[model samples]
Target: MNIGIVVFPGSNCDRDCAYVASDVIGQSAQFIWHQETSLGEMDAIILPGGFSYGDYLRTGAIAHLSPIMDAVKAFAKQGGLVLGICNGFQILLESGLLPGAMLRNRGLSFRCEEVYVRVENAETPFTNQCHPGQVLKIPIAHAEGNYYTDPVTLSSLQANAQVIFRYCDADGQSTGPSNPNGSLDHIAGIRNAAGNVLGMMPHPERCAERALNNTDGFLVFQSMVASLKTQARLTAR
Candidate 1:
């Protein structure tokens, strides 16, 4: 599978994402500058974690207006896979590609640590390699990772199984201490209703290698590659 990792001016993790996709996952990967108007022939798009545009007017507020995001939205409309991590998740929310908004961490501090997120719905393209209720220990680093949405929309997301990952303890229990950013309902990640787009606060690319002593995050990228392979086979048939 070919993956495109978007790079904004302040994007620090684009290369990290590319490394995981290409070296770790054995998939072709390329960097897509934010100003580029075309996505080319990529099968998957990743908005890697970073403080885009210095996170000036709220995280991702300015980056969403870049030329490439329009292409991303269109690609997602066509059922293409899109994954956003950390500040990328902020951009997705700012672009309105995924519902909800990010607020400052409840503690009013930047957090950087390994956190556990339980797979809530593993049937989607982004989480297909994970089983329901599987706990993944991924690292998260951000200040505005707190996720919030209206009550009605939250209920709708829950009803539709759009809630894909939730903050959880090592034992897979959602608890107050387990939520690093105090996101609503312990939401660590979520997919769009179409299930092709996913936005999450964790930095899976950081922990995807066995050398890092944690490979739990590898499943997320593996799942995307698997989904693309499945799509290719179905198309060939």
Candidate 2:
């Protein structure tokens, strides 16, 4: 599958995300400029981890209104796959593509560390390869990763199984320290109602290979590719 990684002015991890697909795993991938309005010949798009716009006004608040995001919104509306990581996750929330808003980390500091995450909705495209409640270790670096939603919204998300990933420990147990940002219910990642868009603070690109530590993140990508293939076949039918 051909993947496009979006790059804004402060997108430090666009290349990293592309390399994970192209170089690390040998898939076709390209860098999509932030100003570009079209998605090009792409099966998937990723808004990578970074301090976009230098987190100038607020995390993802400005970048959410970028022109290219229009195309992304349309792409996602068509049931196309889109993944947002770190600052990208912030952007997704700001763009209203994903539910909830981000708040300052409970500690109010930029955190950089590897932590365990448990898959809560493995049936979704982003986690299809993972079994429900499987634990994966991935790295995260961010300051405002605390996720918040109204009680009614949270209940809705839980009912629809949109709650995708949660912070956990090595043994796949959810706990306090495992939560890097003290997020509500330790929500580290989530998906839209359609299950085509994913927003997560953890950096899957950071662990695309086993040599890096754990290869758990690859299942997320592999599942996405598989989901696209499956969707295509279903449409072809």
For candidate 2, lDDT tens digit of each residue in 12-121?
98988888889776779999888989989889999998989989888998899888999999999988899999999999999999999999999999899888999998
Report the backbone clash tally of model 1.
0
lDDT of 2: 0.91
Q: Score each candidate by Cα lDDT.
A: 0.95, 0.91
Model 2: lDDT of residue 47: 96
Query: Candidate 1 clashing pairs?
Result: none
Q: What is the lDDT of residue 121 in candidate 2?
A: 86
> Which residue segments of model 2 deviate by more than 4 Å?
none
